[model samples]
Target: MYPAADTATLLIDGKWLEADDGATFPVTAPATGELIGRAADAGAAETDRAIDAAAAAFGPWSAETAYARADVLRRAHDLMLERAEDLAVLMSTEQGKPLKAARNEVRYAADFLAWFAEEAKRVHGRTIPSNRRGHRFQVLKQPVGVVAGITPWNYPMSMITRKVAPAVAAGCTIVLKPAEQTPLCAVAVLALLEEAGLPPGVANLVTTARPEPVGERLLADPRVRKLTFTGSTEVGMRLAAGAAATMKRVSMELGGHAPMIVFDDADPVHAAKGATLAKFLNTGQACISPNRIYVQRGVVEAFTEALVARTATLSAGPGTSPGVSIGPLVDDAALTKVQRQVDDAVERGARLVLGGTRLTEDGLDRGCFFAPTVLADIDETMLIYREETFGPVAAVIPFDTEEEVVARANDTAYGLASYLYTRDLGRATRVSEALRFGIVGVNDINPTGAQAPFGGVGVSGLGREGGVEGLDEYLDVKLIGTAL
Candidate 1:
């Protein structure tokens, strides 16, 4: 057994501190089914302290030149690179993803830091065409002051970096609240930034089991000028509502039931593989992972066969185990939810193609390992087809024509990301434009990038998280007018 960490430190203001209430939230390893460490449970008072620190530092931190901020971010990026392996292992231990996948997440997380570091210097405001001859209009981008960053448990490191990097790049101080289940990655990042010589109170992290109290307090405080979060739609709505009372700027990357469509003209082999990977990434916990798949009737049989064959070869075990392609869900609650969805679908006449049974006899009987599942003959009545199955589950529905496929894909309330696999350039262009999602991937499983705008429409969430758009979330544009 690996040695358990003595404490999961909370970085508040400029120093690492313990909880004032003396309460500790235990971090459980989903793979080993054991408690790994106890993180400080930040109460309302502690959150206030962190927010105050962030507020106090905002003036100086945001006053720094873009190059200065870029330099500090770059140093932190280099530190992350040097410790990638250890960071990945720690992430896998906490998040229950395969070691290889965890390492990729670490690299992906570092990419955000490095890319945003350079982009910090490029946070440019535009000059508007003169409406009046005497008055010249110049738009200036200024920092949005202290930002409250709330990140989720899945893809812990990447999620935190995605939010924090952009806010820092835009020269905003931050008070971060990482998910209690996976707070270590954020703590690790805080340590790296501390080592990189970031100014005191510029960035602070507080872990709390009661996210509502902490979140409410942070947003309600007038000192916080911007709010960014990545989590469920319900909670996102509540936070957005709270932030609105103060008219604070808010950006959210919420839940998704993204669709993947396979046209009759597409290569079944390639489409099948791509869909499987996209649907199963992070055991299907990703917000943009393909949840509803529409396949053209002509190629449905072939695609189904290819998908089943590929999924059959996947292995499930602890993240450290050799050749383990998938790991357990985050906890028992997640497992129960997935199982209920499958059961409801079956009752609603949806056909289970593979993995209809729970792996109760496996070594992970007590763990949260649900079988990677595929469903067919699904209709709108089934909960599995309508709700977000944030687990290792995929529903395959066949469509007759392009119009039918497009209609079926857009039937859901979510418009986060969509996938279409076809080699035909004309068809690809038309369908990609037709899809309502903010981001559309054609023959690409990895739809997100540091340079791309990441957000969704309808119930998915509001605003954007990455790209130039993300930096805008942490800035206020002011028109500086002068007659020369």
Candidate 2:
């Protein structure tokens, strides 16, 4: 996953250019707190340049045949898949995900490229049969000019590719601002696109030291016609509001406190495994990952026991290690936040069933590492159950009935993703429809993919990110009528 140093070039208008500011920002690994490498610190001027580039190419790119665009995406996808292993290690070093998970992210990200590549050829206009003689009506979808994509640190490669691939698939050019902490992978993506024969300005990357000025430049610029963001709900709201000032088309996939409900008839062991993976995947940093578990009282004890055993056995180490199940938090602040959450929950009377402390030994003393923690006997009033604990922590609560579980699961303001485990078809059917999440999994932990429509509900943010619905975010509908 190492960069060739000389190849970390910024692609603008088919040319590689240094940030006009002539600045570089150092990237640090969360596992060792050591310097990884420097990424170009794109400033206001550079952001403006990228936007201009995107705007300049929008007309030509949008007017191109869908087959042409699909061809480029397919090439990019094949190249990305071929280099998945290298990209995975690059992500592990910069993003602090386990190497295996990093590989999955690279593969997952590439799948979006492949999926959207095929989707590009499927963007068809609708013919509206006119009632009037010698008159014809047609409704067509046109690509929005330039898209400003703001991606988060978690799942950096996948997030950037997910947004940019669909936008390009819809024939839109893009100016992408990858999170400051993990911008290298975005650069690598641009490299692959360059190799795949995407003309310059169709996809551009910008790295920055300050989020405010760069974000403002992206939002305030009229050339940037659409805004897509994935991050905290608070930040997403602010971006959405700012984009509104210019009436920019906007889509957001924000925060979540997803709920996992296990019915009485579910296998306790299977339910526990799902809960563990869903909660602690990427050390629980995923926006849609399940945060709270509500088990029926009949199976609560067994589920808790199995969960505790599984969570306790998880080995916390560097993400590059082969057998490690969990890795360090993204940074020091995230580690502190998770610790504060556990402390607050325990102070409020939740019983700590497994882990509650950070591991600060065995060369991991300085790293941002928090042990996989499980708290049982948690109540609805507790923050751990009510808020998004974006860390390696799981809080479990017991419920009496399906109605009660559904009510409690939907109690939060965020309705991003949820999980349910039930052997009874009646319960599964009734509960699946009863939950208030945008995406729900029945006896499954991993539900998101390139083919499925992925997004959030409520305060979770607006619009979908994957599937055909995703391409719509970067398009405009136009109706034309004519009489012959």
Candidate 3:
């Protein structure tokens, strides 16, 4: 069972205190439409307080030895693993992912903390050659003061860990603004950090119902030296513009309409299984979820049949339910968006082969549950074909040649991730290189790990989030010159 929702207070300056005005908002479970709990609703004043706390703590925190920071992160990682089961259940309740998937997310989140913990000691700088005699040059890497982390609800636990771990490991303090829909998980995570011995004011959390007061203030504040956000492209663009006024460093992991290309040489069953897992994971709420499928014309019919069979095997219900593969959408708005996209696709002449309607039967009427949907004959003109569905809906488009498929896949404004399935070594190397995405999974659906860099290009946003590069996001370079 999951722990009770944390309704005490927001974490600021290393203390748990109520918002200045004591305002609160209700957090409801998407699975059952039940009230999870009420969370502190921090506004402008609370946001400013968190920022001030992070700024005040930044100097001392950044001055600490890398080993010191690494110790704290390691403790936090151990604590998270010890509490993984509870955290996973909490994630399933608040974030609406299946229990199994939620458990994996917690494990994945812990890996980031551990990875960054070791990486803390390895942040290096080098000596530069001087142009003139009697002159010496050296480069040093240091923390970038206070940071504002804005994360989405899709991967609540992992997103927080991904940003917070690296920021702390890099010796930077942070004010985290978690998605309001899943603030309880963020609260739980903050509690773990505190228990793991994070110093006061080094990490803070402010949850607000309104973005203008909290989110906007962080973006516009000069005290926040960096802004790292993971959410929609629309919001990322707005944050980028606002952050520019203060000349703050920015790292954004925005939206993605990832394409999965299945070649004729690939086994139909294996390709279908991979596509199913990729598309339906987390009920397809992932930013990097495969939104579009391009099958070679010669194998399109067989692949479609296999995909329909695989999709039909998935069980959609509450996340806590046994044997449920797909879970509810985050809210009514998400449900409506998915429904609208499917309807538009059908209206544009795409055929729904598998599941297409909302699941209201079997005690799921109150929740935001959508069936695992598959659409065939999808063309570029269809709304589903052009947009990120962000749901458990896959639109399959047939292509006659590899060149044609590559061109169509790269046509999107978003370039976060792409996937290709083939046994041909030459084709794998060629197509993987041709794909204009930050990450490409050839013959594999899951490409993310602690050792690899994760980010995107084009409208998908800027900067990397994992691996050695992720830690660098919170650091700045300083050049020292000496003349004798």
Please report, in order, the local distance difference test score of every candidate based on alpha carbons. Answer: 0.86, 0.87, 0.91
Give all TM-scores, in the order shown.
Answer: 0.97, 0.97, 0.98
In model 1, state the lDDT of residue 258.
89
Whole-model lDDT, candidate 2?
A: 0.87
Question: Model 1: what TM-score?
Answer: 0.97
RMSD of each: 2.2, 1.6, 1.6
* Span of ten consecutive residues with least summed lDDT in model 3: 1-10
Q: By the lDDT metric, which is better: model 2 or model 3?
A: 3
- Candidate 3 structure quality by residue, lDDT tens digits, 1-484: 1135355558888888767777888898898989988888888888888999999999888899999999988998999999999999999998889999999999999999899999999999999999999999999999999999999999999999999999999999999999999998998888888888889999999987787779888987889999999999999999999999999999999999999999999998899999999999999999989999999999999999999999999998878788989999988888999999999989999999988889999879889999999999999888888889999998899999989999999999999999999999999999999999999999999999986899999999999999999999998999999998
- Candidates sorted by lDDT, descending order? 3, 2, 1
Range of the 10 consecutive residues with the lowest summed lDDT in candidate 2? 1-10
Clashes of 2: 0
Q: List the residue pairs that clash in candidate 3.
A: none
